[model samples]
Target: MLPSCFRNICKNSVLPKKTFGGAFSKNNFATEATFETKPYRLHKLDTSPSTTVTINREDAIKFYTQMNTIRRIETAAGNLYKDKIIRGFCHLYSGQEAVAVGIKAALRPHDGVITAYRAHGWSYIMGVSPLGVLAELCGRQKGCAKGKGGSMHMYSDNFYGGNGIVGAQVPLGVGIALAARYKGTDGVCVALYGDGAANQGQVFEVYNMAKLWNLPCIFVCENNGYGMGTSSERAAASTNYYSRGDYIPGIWVDGMDVLAVRECFRFSVDYAGSGKGPLVIEAATYRYSGHSMSDPGTSYRTRDEIQEVRQTRDPITSFKEKIISANLVTADEIKKIDGEIRSQVDEATKQAKIDAEIGLDELPADVYSQSLEPKIRNVDPFKPLVHKRLGAAVNI
Candidate 1:
């Protein structure tokens, strides 16, 4: 049997192969398709971001392809962790693909993005390749961070990367936004924290500061119901994380829906860039895995509950259905795309396993741009470690 952490997750998530027979070939795509989203619940505002989103065939293909790929990558990560290939603190973002993908869809390339430890999807969307991410997890030389930063610490351009500390990334995200604001650029920073971190004192403090300074930061609380071992109801005084901003405007979004997530981000970018200060967005999403790789995820929540979410609210499954029904692409095309992604993930996993680990001699590499001291002394002072600058600062 597979590890319980990966229970109910379909690695391929393949849409059943069917012969199109050229029935719907004529209308392979419409110029654009309009879909209504789940209504947004607004705080401190009268109007909401439009519930209607317009997506073209290209948009549909992009979202489905990216979302499915994220799901497959996470599933592969879970399997590697089970096989003990990827070790330590692996958080699978199997069900939260829509949130990151949707946000990216609505964001500018230069816009900053920072999130919690469950950030493989964010890293991929932020331009880290599947191979780079998997290699990083496997601690191989080809990793995005060159094998130094593991599951939680990969960084990319305009991406602050995932912070291991619960709420530490919030302030960093604000600073990224602050820098953009300082530079007078139109980019915004998206700082995402989990519901578990929602009650952090620093979150509220930064909210006040962000509002006071009117920084172009979009603070997001990814309320995935259960934080680590506890449910939101047990951990939080009020799960109304969006409304907790008080002074800052907040929007409650259905994170399971990619289009809805996109609209919320689009709304947030506009509002924040318009000198309206920061906005709080609560993405009501769910994670299939436990908080990290260690937990079974079944102890806090029932197997039945997890199964139900996979069947009903799964971001990838639902979006796949939506696009297929809308005729953006045929089911056969989807199955083929799924096959391609699976091959890519499998190949990446194989390469990651074969890639060499950084040697002990290079232990002190990539620590600093320039060091005053020639050697970093170890517990055994005689074997002083020499810091080697192998490559440029940015790995990905």
Candidate 2:
């Protein structure tokens, strides 16, 4: 039995009476209710000036939980893809959780976010449900994109698509920023692209336009060391992606560190919002998975190298250690959070598997504006094409 004083304290406490999987109930502890403000020193990968990074205990736990959730969800996605549940090209954002989570942490709900094909984590962080992401992967009707978008095209409010075309989202992101500026809103658009996309001709074109208009946009290059199966060193003459935007000031950040990413993102967002024009941020991150599910991920990089990164520089593990060392939360609390996330992912996967598959009729829908009718080709070459009338209701 608990001590009388502790029991009374629990009953009288004004904070939210939530328990951590019943583990803290007996101890009269509330892990989520506790928070401690601490100064977080910034570590810039480039010569950019330093800034302070502050994280309270509550925020730390939240970040840890979010990162863990992304990791588990990606793991579940890999399993689903391997089992043939998810079709088409599926890219798992396993090792790069911190970048998405950290960037989202620094943005407002109305701020825009656009990224490349590896965007399940970004979708989730930008307010899309995990079940929606999983369903979209499985081509189910209840997906965020209604199963039409599939793995490379999930969209949400203020969160643009997982564009299949490399670097295509960069121009779209710039358009969003221009729209925001034209409307005189204090919103900034974060345009995220892979190292490979950074080399695209259109990206530089958009960069020139963005700087010319002084659009409140951030060009974030996720330099995961590899572009597809090729390393960045082999792909580009210079790997200094941050400085790629000649006139635009840039910052290089240690993307493996959540705090650093979050702090740097906050700074960039503020800088852009101040009408300083577009800024570039090159995040030195990594992806443990292959370019896609098909690649073995070991043909170019050795297994030892992958294992070393997982062992030493893993974002989730390192953040957990930081929290524990700071005495913010007990190891048991972190374990409980991990267990909860695993269960959540398991349930989401089960639901995604059983969800109804999208109907073929949806192919013609959403093809054009509601005011314009569009004709779709028939599967049979000899058959007449079907014309979908405008304003016609689609059966969900």
Candidate 3:
């Protein structure tokens, strides 16, 4: 048997190539309308005055809406989990909304993205409706995975999944990049894993392959300090995950700030699309929830520690403050967005709860092969005439 931590992952890895249903399902699969190849540059998000880029009100509103949608969706999921309306292992992307918003801001629809299990935020920004994701959490047939893949196996269009097995996505990401190169497309792949997964051997192996093949891949390490409650300092010998890529130019980014993430991802996208090979960007982010929903995050880390991060570096609040202070958005506008998000989440949760969940029959259907025939002991099975005659004379 596989290790318990990886058993579910192995099962999910075999999902059949079928279209997932739900609100986002209308355009979930690749069709004629996929994004066009566009060349762009990767620009590091720098706090330095010299590197600052001006943002207008319209752009600010768009990003803020995206971030708010992720936040509200996750908050709704958390409440649903608490209410027992959702089951199985649920990982909330509460604190890491900025990372998704920032990075997605730099990507087009054709670019590929894959992330770790804490992937609700990424899915939200990728145009996967809140109802679709919530339906998956509720195990409804209207889910992104057609009610099959609970929290850890979400997929849409070019978005691969919220893969559970740490570090496994690295090599797969390189393969996607290789395919893009072979097709002569300007597409890039953003492969993300957590700080805990950074220590996995497969990550390094893929890093080597990506460099050797000159794949247009951006390996993002969402180093949130703690790997399933273990502090990064204790888990990793070298805390600088960005520098882990010895062969590639690595960028260390402030992941708590959306602007910072956007700037860094933009730079990485541009650099990779320019055929400069793979780049590594380590976004030092944090997860507010326990490893899964089961572990209380406060047990290993102090409540005070969590509170400190919330008060000091909450990404959404920080961005809101900046926008308001810079007069890019007003309080009324922010409140309007917040209200819309709240309503959207509430509707999604209600719809998800009402949708029919998938059953055990779904398990066998998505696999690569099926059992050929049923065994019958009471009577002799029908034998082919040719097979019987040939076997009677020649028994191999």
lDDT of 3 at 19: 24
Rank ordering of all candidates by lDDT, starting from the highest: 1, 2, 3
lDDT of each candidate versus the true structure: 0.83, 0.79, 0.74
Residues 1-396, candidate 1: write the lDDT tens digits: 322212212331223222222333355554456677766778998779987787777888899999999998999899999999998889999888999999999898778999989989999989999999999999998999888889999988888887899999999899999999999888899999998899899999999899999999999998788778887877877777899989998988888889889988888898887788899998888888888888999887789878877887788888888777777777998999999999999999999989999866566566764567776554233454444575433221
* Per-model C-alpha RMSD: 7.3, 10.9, 12.8
lDDT of 1 at 104: 95
TM-score for every candidate vs. truth? Answer: 0.87, 0.83, 0.80
Stretches of candidate 2 off by over 4 Å are 1-51, 368-396
**Model 1 / residue 357 / CA error / Å:** 1.1
lDDT of 2 by residue, 368-395 (tens): 4343434454433445344467444333
- C-alpha lDDT (0 to 100) for residue 388 of candidate 2: 68
- Please, what are the lDDT tens digits per residue for candidate 3 over residues 1-396? 211112222232321122212222242322211111111112332322113444555677888888788878888888889999888888988888878888988997779998888878787778788999999888898888887788998888888888888788888888889888999999999999988999999999998999898899999888777788787777888867777888777876667767667766777788799898998887766777888889888777777666767886677887787666555567888999999889989999999989986654344344322445563221222321223555552212
The Cα error of candidate 3 at residue 293, in Å, is 0.5
